[model samples]
Target: MKIRHLRNATALLTLGEHRLLIDPMLARPGSIPGFKFFGGGRRPNPLVPLPPDTFSWLEEVTGVLVTHPHPDHLDTAGIRWIREHGLPVWTSRLDAPGLGKRGLTVHSLEDGALGMGVERIPVRHGRGLLAWLLGRVSSYYLAHPDEPSVYITSDAVLTEDLLEAVERLQPDVIIAPAGSANFGVGGDILFSVDELVTLVRRAPGGVVLNHLEALDHCPTTREGLRERMKAEGLLEKVLIPADGEELHFARPERARGPAAPGPGATQERERASLASGM
Candidate 1:
């Protein structure tokens, strides 16, 4: 499998013949409003533009995997592009209907949906009312017979149940949000640096960190994160890819059996549709 990191939370995941675009935010830089609402330092979002070769990459996308309906994850430009390309969109049950209303083909991203072993793991976008207002989001674990298994933790805070899922699944690669984003209040909405350290230590295989240096709210920088990882003796285990970079993974010698969706951290699939963080 090859994962081509495009931009913030947007990547082209290749599993065998499938090239699935994950959470596309295809807007030009500064088109979206700033996300940092307090404590100053707010600027128009998408701090940087997509890579020069982004259009070439999009031509190969067979489908899209949306983790949520947030603007940063799936903005207006991304929606229009998908429609123009006539591509199928796979997402959690909670997000499928809303995405379909936006005029894109939508399908459930559950186990057995895409000719692969898929598991939908629910996660908390933040704590207390912030999480509630952020609405429901999900992480996906995909296992293909000819490719390595991967767990994509779409925006989430640290939680015991999530760690348990990691321990249980033991995916070959883990792609997590490392932006440590906050609206300048209510603590961090994504994983803190310390939490990321802990997570790296626990991961059995390589861990790819994204969601950095692309948004106004996400304070984590790739250079700073790399230095911290080096300090923590995790440089070998973690990969902080630059925009437009790609990483390849092959199935290990000890591959596991077919993946089954766990009950996951949260079971309440029904929730309000408030994609608050724009």
Candidate 2:
């Protein structure tokens, strides 16, 4: 599998024959309003533009995966691009109806939706009343039959359910947002640097961090995060790719030991927990 990190949470994820564009925020720099509501540094969003080669990579996208409808995740430019390309958008059931009303061809991402084992892992976007106001977000675990599995933890704050998903799935690659975003008053809407350290430590496979240095509200820098990870002896296990940088991972050879549970097993547990209010 290959993941090319674009600006913010947008990435070109190549798994098998599919090139899924994840959470595209395709806008010119400063085109959107600022997200930092409390702190003084309230500059317009998308502090930087897409890398020069972004259009070339975008041409390969076969589908779009939107974890939510936040403007930062899917802005006007991104929606326009998707409509022009006529690409299929795969998103959570909770978001399908609203997104469909906006005229994009939307599909709910369920188990086996894209010829892969899919699990929607819910996460908190903030704390307390702020979390409720930030709305719901879904992280996805996608496992293909002949490739390394990946878990895309969309914009979220640290949570027990997230940790549990990492521990249980042991995906080959885990992609997470590391912007450390805050509207200044609500504390943090995304993972703090400390939480990212812990999350990377808990992940058994490679961890890819994105959502850095793109928006004014995101304070974490890639260099700062790299230094922190290095101090924690976690530099080797993480990939803090620059915008437009692509990293590849091949499946590991199977061991001749007892077979582990199928990828669908964890999704079943997740669904049950959601149903029971656990």
Question: How many residue pairs collide in each prediction?
Answer: 0, 0
TM-scores of the candidates are 0.92, 0.91
lDDT by residue for model 1 over 100-203, one digit each (tens)?
Answer: 89999999998877788988899999899899999998999898876778899999998997898889887778999999999998989999999999999988
| Model 2: per-residue Cα lDDT over 71-156, one tens digit each | 99999999999999999999999999999998999999998888888889999998999999989999998887767788999988
* Model 2, runs deviating above 4 Å: 255-278
Provide the global lDDT of candidate 1 against the true structure: 0.87
lDDT at 191, model 2: 95
RMSD after CA superposition, every candidate: 8.2, 8.8
Model 2 TM-score relative to the real fold: 0.91
Best model per TM-score: 1
TM-score of 1: 0.92
- By lDDT, the best candidate is 1
